[model samples]
Target: MTATYAEHSARKRRPLFRRRSAIPGFAVTMGVTITILSLIVLIPLTAVALKAAQQSSSEFLNAAFNERALMAYRLSFGAAFIAATINGVFGLLTAWALVRYEFPLKSLVNGLIDLPFALPTAVAGIALATLYAPNGWIGALVAPAKVAYTPLGVVVALTFIGLPFVVRTLEPVMRDLAADVEEAAASLGASRFDVIARVILPALGPAWLTGFALAFARAVGEYGSVIFIAGNMPYKSEIAPLLIIIELEQYDYAGAATIAVVMLVVSFAMLFVINAVQAWARRLSA
Candidate 1:
């Protein structure tokens, strides 16, 4: 009877809202995360928006859509998109080779994949310019066609920096894929191309899209590496970030803010679309 009374008392003591979690301090952790994000990301973005808002609508439009600014936007977004696309294809191939094959100096090759990440952007720009300049070794091979100090150079620099994003994002996904799945598909009379297209690619679609988005985002804001190679020619190879710096230098804070707001909006829109595609891919794979 005492034991039965103790059980009843214990049940009564339990709170209605009490629920256990695998990780403790959920409320505290969430609060900390929100605070950090606000400090690091949201607040700065808000400040930019506020600064842009200070401008009259016509002034903002004039600053953002001026002929030179439009050209810069074209160069920036166009080069970034092209570079990311190239990386998407070649990066997948590179990741596949690293995961599935054995080759000479395999460890060294794997390590070298991360070189871009560690190399400073300015250093990378200088190195690329040296190698691709008309007088340089590789540049001599393509002497007739200008590479360095052209928009092509901007694309090359962006591609170099963005490659690692796609490769790194896809590597773990490829590593975890089961060889048996491919073999089984073969046994069912699937051709090699078909197997890759139908089985492997579908499974990797979400991750591939994620990598592409990351590469695009990184390339969009790239400045340090591109300036050395791009020649900074207005309405030609000039990129948006350089234009922003030029505005800042000229003490056109409102103009700079307007350009920044445009970039932010476009980048956010592209990311949103990519995320939607990733979600669709996930659903299809599942």
Candidate 2:
């Protein structure tokens, strides 16, 4: 009997020792991940760099930094920055309202927040252009403001698409925040403004930065939606991506590559700085 019991116990222990994880081994998984990343991301970026390098340094500089390119860059980066700032402020308010308050049609409103994501960029552009045309409904209401076919319209289009990034990034963080903390602050004689400024903002600072960075990045690369509204006027409302397409259309691949390289470098640098700041904020909040 003792031998029988011992054999059964050993069978159970053997299965425990023999069981394997469902995932592949780390080496295999890591190798596959690196191979995929190289194929999809690294190789294309390298090709772009090499293509741009085909041009002489002066040629590259002229292509990337000429009057037309500079104007386009200014508009693209400036509009993206402004749009991201707007999204950051209003996205916070929207997320806060969703998480902290009860309202009629709450579910419908929450669902609508993701409308931009499901909507195609071209469709969104056309819809926005029609709605904001000087003769259109909302445009007629704000007559003489000149929304569509201007730099302002570019900002508006960017803000429309980028808002979802900020709001979604903030929603999870806002939900994680405990109401007890606010109650505790209130019970201790802190006013509503004081509670928000001192208690809520600190906890959300990192997430806010992350959301702002995401929105800015999305807006920087936007093309289809912005082109429809911006009117693509050179030195006026043209954006950097539009310049890239124009270069391609003119059969100036090297010039297009140079412009792309410049945008890529600037965008990467900005995102790196934003991420660093986000990390610092996280450390401080911790």
Candidate 3:
């Protein structure tokens, strides 16, 4: 009877999580995390909301949806989407190469992958502009096509900044993939294309989507890297973040906040959709 009672007490004492975690003080850690996030993220967003509330509905609509603002939105989101898509494809290839078969100076190439992350946006923009400008080296090669000081320049800048996100995100997943599964598939007469398309792609789909989403999000708010190459023509290559800066410079605080709020809402919706897709992919894989 005593043993039965002891067993019941021990069972009740067991942690809800079956495995013991290396980290301790879950409640304290959770509280700290919430506090930090509130101070850093939630508080600023709340401030933006409060500032935007100062504007009347008509004023907000006029500021956010004016012809110039609309054009800026189109350019910004369009360039970001295009850049992220480019990154998704090339980044996957880069990650695969880094993981599978390394060549000469492979370590140098790996280090270079993170160059954009360490380089200042302004510096990167200037370098890209210099390299792609009509009179510049690479620019001379594609001179008639016209890259710098155009929407194409904006796309190039965005692609430069966004590439690392996709490459880094996919690298670990590629490294962890089981080689035996690939070998087994090949031994069963699966073509290389079939192995990549039917076996490898499905496994990496969620991570690829996550990387694409992150790249898109990062590109959407990019300012410094874009301005130098974009030329910032109001109705043409002007981006939304540049528009916000213009509003701020003109002391149109409410207008800036409204634009920011709109961007926040749209970005949130996009990220939410991406997250839903990722969740669906995870379920399918499982």
lDDT of 2 by residue, 1-286 (tens): 9999999998887855566899999999999999999999999999999999999989989999999999999999999999999999999999999988999999999999999999999999999999999998888999989999999999999999999888899989989999999999999999999998999999999999999999999999999899888999999999999999999999999999999999999999999999999999899889
How accurate locally is residue 144 in candidate 1, as Cα lDDT from 0 to 100? 95
lDDT of 3 by residue, 40-150 (tens): 999999999899999888998999899999999899999999999999999999999999996999999999999999999999999999999999899999969999999
Please report, in order, the local distance difference test score of every candidate based on alpha carbons: 0.95, 0.94, 0.95
List of clashing residue pairs for candidate 1: none
Model 2 bad stretches (over 4 Å):
1-19
Error of 2 at 224 (Å): 0.9
Candidate 2 similarity to native, TM-score: 0.92
What is the Å distance of residue 151 in model 2 from its true position? 0.6
Model 1 residue 93 CA deviation in Å: 0.4
Which regions of candidate 1 are displaced past 4 Å?
Answer: 1-24
Per-residue error at 94 for model 1, in Å?
A: 0.5
Candidate 2, run of 10 with poorest lDDT: 11-20
Model 1: per-residue Cα lDDT over 1-286, one tens digit each? 9999999999999887878877759789899999999999999999999998999989999999999999999999999999999999999999999999999999998888899899999999999999999999888999899999999999999999999999999999999998999999999999999999999999899999999999999999999899999999999999999999999999999899899999999999999999999999999999
